[model samples]
Target: MAGPRAFAAAASLSMLFALSPATAQTPPTESIQIGLSTDAISITAGFSGADLTIFGSLENPDPLIARQGRYDVVVVLEGPPRPVVVRRKDRVLGVWINLDSEAFENVPVSYSVATTRPLQDIAEPAKYKQLSLGAQNLYMKPVDETDSPATIEEFTAALRERKTATGLYSENVGGVQFLSQNLFRATVRLAPNVPVGTHKARAFLFKSGMFVKESSAQLEIRKSGFEQSIFRVAHDYSFLYGVFAVSLAMLTGWLGRLIFRKD
Candidate 1:
C-alpha cells in the first residue's frame, strides 16, 4: 500500500513539471505605438514665439497585466551654416528664468530619455529607445548678399567668432551640467548680434558618434515691435527736449524785449 501511494504522488509532481513549460512559454504582448504631430512642419520667415508640438501614442493589449506608461520627449533644432540656439524657461516659485542652453553646429543634438513606467510594465522599452525624434538640414541659404552658403571652413570660423563675441556665457544652471547626457534639457542661445533674418535649423539623432537619423526645421529672426519702441522712445525724448529748450529761450527773449521797450 505504501509503495503504491508514493508512486502516485511522484506521478502527480511529474505532471505539474510538464505543464510549467507551457505556462512560461506564453509570449508578452506588445502594447506601444508612436506617432508624430504631423508628417511635416513648416516655419515661415520672421517666425518667433512659435511653439512646435510632438505627439506620441501608447496602448496596452494584455487585459490581465495592468501597465503604467511614461515618456521622455526631446526636441532638437539644427542649422548647417550657422548654429541655432535653443532655450527653455524654468519656473522657480513664481518667476520664470532661462534654465540652460546648448549649441550644435557641426555636431548633432542628443539627449537621454526616461519613462514613468517600470521596466516590467513597459512592454518594449527597447523599441521606444530606437525611435528617432529630430530634424536635419535640407538646404541653408544666406540671409545677406555678402553672406554665402556656409562651408565647413565657414562654420568653424563662425564658431570662433561667436566664442570671441560672447566670451562664454553661462556654463551650467539649476544644478544641471551643460552637454551632459544625464540631463534631459539642453538648448543653444542665439547671440545678441545674430543677424536679423530667416535661418534654417535642422535636428538629428546620433549614437556612438555615427548618424542614426535626421529631420529639418526652420528659424526666423526678424525685427520686433520692441526694437521699434526703443527707437521711438529715443526720438520722442530728443524732440520733447528740443522743443522745451526752444520755448524757454523764446520766453526769456520776449521778457527782455518788453523791458527794453518800457525803458
Candidate 2:
C-alpha cells in the first residue's frame, strides 16, 4: 500500500492537472499559487499532525516591488465542516452530569492561518472580518435557529475553546515570511484531529495594507493501508464489524489460555 508521502505526490499531480488549464489562460489572478511545495496532504495511521510548508510567489512583470510600500501575504488552510455537539457538564451529588447541550452546524473541523505581518497591521478590523482573514472572525452559524442568541453565542465560544485546546483551530500572526520579496513560504501545522476530506488552501495578497488579489488550492486527506480497510468495513457493515470484533476478542482469549495452560 502507498504511504502518506506517496499519496501527497499523487495529490500534487492531481492539483497541477486540475489547475494547469486555468493558469495558462488567466490574465494573472490575485498573483499567487499554492503548488509551491505540495498542494495536498494525506494522513495515514499513526499520524500526529505535521508541519506543512506552503510555498508561493508573486507573479508580476514589474520589479519585485512596484513602487509600493510593501506587500503582505496571508495563507490559511481549512478542513471540512460538520455538525458538532458541545455539552456542558455539571457536578451533581459527587458526580458530573450533562447539564446543557448545544448542537452546532458547519463548524470547521480544522483551521490554521499564517500571515506576513500581524493581522492588525495588515488591514483594519472591519476589512479582516469581511475577508475572513482571522480565525476569530470565521463564520460559524448555529444549526438550530430556535435557540436563543445568548445560548448560541455561549455554545459557539465553548466550541471554539474546545477546538483550540486540541490544536484544531489556530491563528498565527506573522507566520508568512518573504524569502526574497517575490518568493515566500509559510509553515502551518495540521492537527491530528483533522477530519478526512478535501481541505482548502487559500492565499491572499495585500499591497500596501489593501487587499489586492487571492488564490486557492485544495488538499485531500484520507486514510490508507490497514486503517483504510478497517474504516471502510466498519462504516459499510457496522453490525458485522462489531460482531467480528467481539468474536476476535473471544478467540484471542481462548488462544491465550490454551498457550499458557499448566498442570
Candidate 3:
C-alpha cells in the first residue's frame, strides 16, 4: 500500500536518475511495457475470479518535458463476449409479468477500467472513443434486425447498469497509481462470473491530454482440475454427458431407497 507521499518521493528520485549525465544524450522515446501478474486463470467448482495486478514502466523520454506536465495512465480490461437478454417486468392485474424485452449479441461479459484520473480529464470523448479508453466507447449491438437506435441505446444502458451492479463492468478513476515516476501499478478484480476465454487488456499513456503510447496483452481464464475435465466432456460429448448424468442420478436414488427402506 504505497501512499501518495511515498510515490512522490519515488518519482522525485526517479527523475534525478533520468537527468544524470551518464546517459543523457539518448534520443527521445515515448513507450511503455505492460504485463499481467499471471498468464492463465484456472477455476473449479467454487471458482471465483481473482485479483490481477497490472504493472508497467513508462520511458522518461525527456525528463525536462515530463517534469513540465505529468503523464496519465489508463488501462482497460475486457473479456469474451456472450449474448445477453434484458427484460422489463410490470405488475399486471394479479401478478408481475415480463413486458418489453431486448436482446443483445456479442456483449462483453466483463469490462473494467482503471485510470490515474477521470477519463474525461485525460481525453475528450472523440479522442477517447478513437482509442477505446473507457467503457462508454464499447459498441454493444442489438441482436434484433430492425431495432430503433434509441431503443438500442436504452438496452445498452440497461446492460451496463446490470453489469455494473454485478461488478462485471466498472470504472475506477484514480485507481492507477504511480509507484515511481516511470513505474505504475493497477489492481483489477475480475468478477466471479467472468466469461471463460481469452480477454484483452490494454494500456494507454496520455500526455498533454492526448493519446500516445499504447500496448495490448491477452489473458486466458479457464476451468481447471475436475471442473476443467467436466467442462471439456460436457461440451465435446453432450449426449454422452447427459446419459451419464441420468444414470448417476438413478444410481443415487436407488442407493438412497435401499438404505432407507425396511419392512
CA displacement after TM-score superposition, residue 223 of candidate 3 (Å): 1.7
lDDT of 2 by residue, 1-263 (tens): 34334223211222212234455556344466655345445567777667667777776513434435378888998889888899999899989999899887787789898887788888888888788666777767777889999998888888888888999988777678776546677777777677788888888888777788888888877766688789999999999999999999999999999999885
Q: Report the Cα lDDT for candidate 2.
A: 0.74
Number of backbone-clashing residue pairs for each candidate, in the order shown:
12, 0, 0
Report the lDDT tens digits of candidate 1 across residue range 33-82.
22232333332223332222222222222223222112222233322244
TM, every model: 0.27, 0.79, 0.80
lDDT of each: 0.33, 0.74, 0.75
Error of 3 at 219 (Å): 1.1
Please identify model 1 stretches exceeding 4 Å from their true place: 1-164, 167-185, 229-263
lDDT of 3 by residue, 58-106 (tens): 8754555566546888888889888989987888997889988899888
Best by lDDT: 3
Give lDDT for model 3. Answer: 0.75
